[model samples]
Target: MSPERYARINQMLDNRQTDLTLCLDTVHKTQNIAAVIRTADAVGIHQIHAVWPDAEMRVSGNTASGSQQWVKTLQYSSMSEAAKQFNLQGMQVLATNFSDKAVDFRDIDYTKPTVVIMGNERDGVSDEGLAIADQHIIIPMLGMVQSLNVSVASALIMYEAQRQREQAGMYGTRQLDEAYCQKMLFEQGHPIYAKACRRKNIPYPSIDAQGQIEANATWWQRMREPDPNADEA
Candidate 1:
């Protein structure tokens, strides 16, 4: 990536809070999954936990539009397992469903560490998923349709979170801790080099905000030079 691009990413990263996440429970449609992932990234969600029985989920390049690369997508076989993990991390899981206990979506506190759980396209959230949710939320619908698409619902909830966070200054500086910001900036700046280093279990050379090599500058400089071994006229 160019230096300017790297700077922009770092700026966004500085405003990325890991407190909020999205959880998809057995959502079968690839397009819906892709759309949700795209919206999650757009709203600066840190991670997405997706639970499917088998590893049949796939996102088309056209549908996902490279958003998956920016957002961390984690897969689990069981909704219980995903819920367990998040709960262990002290995150409150809120499922979207219609129930007597369901509260208005606008009333929920988005400033807390939260996981917005969405259910299948047809059946809605699984019973097990609902059982573990800290709260249930419903978007009041007055139209005849009575329900929105899973992707649209997710976008609505996530953008509302974005709005709330923006209001609370949650999107301000210190969104990501210092260590994470540095690591993400390094990876974004040198993706190929980062992958190569990971494959070899080596640490990638660091780069500053201007995209200048920080560690082992001599090594990178030598590699950039033309090979004298090649035959030339």
Candidate 2:
């Protein structure tokens, strides 16, 4: 990685909001998934959760690969399973639902360690999700359309969270684990080498200040040697 690239990646890591996250309760569209991931990255949210039981509905490798590289999407087999984990993490769960009791989306305190759940495109939030959510939120609309697209709603809510966080001075300081940051720096800065490490099961080497790989002689030797079983039956 070039020095400039190294600095840019470092800057992004510095602003990561580890506490704020989003949960997609089976929002299966590829375009929507990609948009949400990109928006999440824009707001410095390094992690998001998803509950997609159908393998086909999950975010594919090609969907927003750039954003996917920076944002980790933790997948869950069920919505309740994901909700329980959120509760365990002590996050205030807010679901975007259309209901009489739902509050204006902007009214919620986004400054808190929170997870905003955006439901599936058509069905909206499942009964299980609604039951577990700490509160139901809705974006007020002036016209006739009662709801926005899943991705659009997610972007608006995420930006609102970002605005609240900015006011609270939550950005600019690093909150991610040191090891995790190092891993991200290495993978993002040195994509080719990182790919090789995964392909060969080689451990990742430390990244230097200049974004150069700092590996022991053994690692260098391993990199030099091509994968012997490159092709097999």
Candidate 3:
């Protein structure tokens, strides 16, 4: 990688938020998904958990631009499964839904570990998602239209989260785990090398300060070595 590219990768990895994430519940529109991914990357969100049981999750290249290549998007077979994972991590799962019990979006403390859920295009948050959410939040509307587009709503809510985290000094220092950061750098800086490492079920070779791989012939031979205890197939 070029020195400039290495510096850019380091800067992004350093500022990436570990606790903040997005959850999409059965949202199927390509453009909407693309927009959400773009906004999440802008706000330093590293991963997006999506529950799309009925459709294969795909992002549009045009709408996402290059963000589809940067941010990680994880697909889940069910909302309950996704919610359980985030809840286990102590995340405050807030679903975007308009309800009598819902709180204002701006009122929540976004500085804490949070997973903001964006509902499907037509139905909004699923019943399962609402049941799993720690809280339900809504963006106040002024016009005759009751609610904003899913992507638009997502951008507003995410930027608010970014603002709160920034005020709390979360963005001033590195938050991602070092081990994970190394893996990300390997994947981003030298994708083909990273793929080979994965193919061999071996840990990725270390990345130098210049964002270049430290892989050598010894590393490849080590990865190709057979397991000593393997039984006859």
| lDDT scores in order | 0.83, 0.90, 0.87
Highest lDDT scorer: 2
Instruction: Write candidate 2's Cα lDDT for 118-153 as tens digits.
Output: 999999988878988889999999999988999999
Tens-digit lDDT string for candidate 3 (1-233): 78887888888887788789989989898999999999999999988999989878978777799898778999999988897789788999999998888999999999889999899889999999999888899999888999888999999999999999888888858877888888878888888767666666677888898787788898878666765445769
Worst 10 residues of 3 by lDDT: 223-232
TM agreement with the true structure for every prediction? 0.86, 0.94, 0.86
Top candidate (TM-score):
2
Q: For residues 1-233, write the lDDT of model 1, one tens digit per residue.
A: 78687878876686676889988999989899999989888888877989998876788878999887778788899987897789787988899999999998989999889998999998999998999999999999998887899999999999898999999987757666666666777777777767655555555565675765577766566555555554686
Off by over 4 Å in 2: 60-65
- Cα RMSD of all models vs. native, in order, equals 4.0, 1.7, 4.8
lDDT of 1: 0.83
TM-score for candidate 2: 0.94
* Clashing residue pairs for model 2: none
